[model samples]
Target: MEKLILTRLNVLGHPGRMAVFRLLMRRLPDAVPAGEIGQALAIKPSTLSVYLSALCGAGLIGQRREGTSILYSARAQAGGEIVDFLFNDCCRGRPETCAPVSRVFREGFPDMSDRKYNVLFICTGNSARSIFAETILRDQAGERFDVYSAGTRPYSQLDPFALEVLKAKGHDISGLRAKNVSEFCAPDAPQMDFVFTVCDQAANEECPAWEGQPVSAHWGMPDPVKAEGTDAQKSLAFQQAYGALRNRILSFTALPLDSLDRISLQKAVDDIARETPEVTT
Candidate 1:
């Protein structure tokens, strides 16, 4: 830990490297091409190459090859740790000293707090899985987001078990009806910031182009409505679906949206689908 701290300090010790890192932070969650970074800082390409290499070696920044260009972004985890370490140690007894740093990190990037993100969850029938996600997100962070669910092939109503499990968990089951996805495709419809397909069928279907080009990913899960068995067995399926959607929605709402650019946010949401769900019934 000490070694990493010293390495970060040494990398940022040079003025040129410091300039590069500060510029990268201002563009958090977006990777800047090497040429663009050099141009922005008015540094010669040859000299800038040395600084980029040093920062990358210290794990302060990361690079990825994008076609012919190498793009770099400030490594958020590493940068965050350094800030945490400094704040903890320097302000050990002086808590007030940390406020300015906290304020800067909170307000430094593009402000996304004032706006509520519109998120739509989609499934084939919207009777179960999609409804579960909508309710879960609404329970989780309804104030920060506008959550909705729909189906490609509409169901006349929501699945009974889906409502049963939600009501058991104390989620508001009101105003939840299965609707066709077309309703949200109108010109006057609310623009979505995120769209998720929670069933394989909906994921495979061709979707209408959204107004804002929302970040989308598949969060496919087994359709609990199709689980055929005794009453207890069928109810267990709804519980499992609820658990899975609850876990995913919790993770989604916890993201630091203000600090993440669209590209990073897209990858983050896609990665959530790969994580194992924790059953919480």
Candidate 2:
């Protein structure tokens, strides 16, 4: 243990090696490609190779071969030990001195490895508003949520406006289709954690009960595809809807889902629609 600590300290003593270690540490639990690391630090390939070898030799960093790309990440366990050592020894008997530092590291990145929650967004036609909401939530927190979209009256095809706006915002439009709400009411549908209606009509409609009676909310937004205007005006309307859904999705992600109960969560989800910033083109 002492030898490993000494080796880690020695490796960190160099400016270049320490920079590389810091970069890798930021993206812990997610191995970054070697090219990304090199590009980030702007270190020459030959020199970066030597530093990486030193850190890897000390067991403070690890490398994994992912197909053709070599990925690198900080050794989390070892890194935590080193951080503890610094906190314990530097503070001596003054625990309060390092308390803030400890909190920052522990709380800065909350646990995001919870089991994925299945969510469905609904609208009148499942074309513009619902589809945009679905894609935004999926793109924002795909790690924690499995998202789907449906409508009370399903459309024959996806709305071109929704597709254009989503693609423009770098969302994956592959396999996105306009589906009906009845598909989820069937016996074999995946249970949902949350359901949101993105249009007033869908939210007000009397629909069949969901399987889990999932926590439902109304996040009504304008139907961009229904806008009767010139091409430029229609484009702006879609952009506005996209922005509104993006804001609400971000608010949803910020909630403490684990800590809130059903009633509280329902209120919280409902409040998102009421409190989110207004949408504009």
Candidate 3:
């Protein structure tokens, strides 16, 4: 029986099948059509069909016939099994190192139940650090709070290096765009809970006070795109920025907001802003 189970697992180890499975895992609940998967991965339809068939045969994916199209999604049980398999031997046999990250999803803000708490990151260009913070917060605190990012002066483009680093780390940034913060500070803007200036210039500049007099903080990061040197040196700058922001956001999300008073939470955010390490070469 053990041998038979190993044989079944081996079927999913194929590169093509693994790719299809990972894509489906990332897009749970949504049934991806066969053609879309092929296009996204640049796999030929005929080739993808073979891999999809293998996955279906192994019961790792579920297929639905929608009209003439066949849609596929990761089987929830199979997905769990895959995760277990991947991490079963991780941490060099230290079980504690494999614990899952925790998230908070509770009612009410730190003090005000009636007011919703929203976090907005502002920068001169919304292409790098601001965007990183926005996405990382969403990933870390998706259930408890709302997060957004924009620029005082919007850039015409996103830094390709930033996009590449995010993709390499398995974070999706599709449909994200650089927009001006003016859109949020307009008279009809949604009441912000916190406004974070993520660049030195934006932090120091005098701007219209946000609606509702939201608590403001400055979390400045050196502009990674401004790093000068070879291609590899510039790429390292983006990675350093990403790592620094990720660590700070991790610490911020771990705050015991539900138990802390408003004053405590404010102090905590300030300390977090002041103490996070500056990324460097």
Q: Which lDDT value does model 3 have at 264?
A: 61
TM-score of each: 0.61, 0.59, 0.58
Residue-wise C-alpha lDDT for candidate 2, range 1-281, written one tens digit per residue: 66688789999999999888876654433466767677767888999999999999999899989899888877767877877777777776355788665554433322336668889998988888888888888878888899999999988998887788888888889979989898998888888878887775565455566764566776776688788889889898889988888888999999998776554676688678778885855
Q: lDDT tens string, model 1, 10-102? A: 899999999889767545445679887887778999999999999999999999998999999887678777877787777772447787666
- Mark the regions of model 2 whose C-alpha exceeds 4 Å error after superposition: 1-114
lDDT of 3 by residue, 174-246 (tens): 9678989888977776778777777765654445656555656666677998999999999999999888888
- TM-score of candidate 3 on Cα atoms, chains taken together: 0.58
| Top-lDDT structure, candidate number | 1
Candidate 3 Cα misplacement greater than 4 A, ranges: 1-116
Candidate 2 has a TM-score of 0.59
- Estimate the lDDT of model 2: 0.78
RMSDs, each prediction?
13.6, 18.0, 18.7
> What do the candidate models score in CA lDDT, each in turn?
0.81, 0.78, 0.73
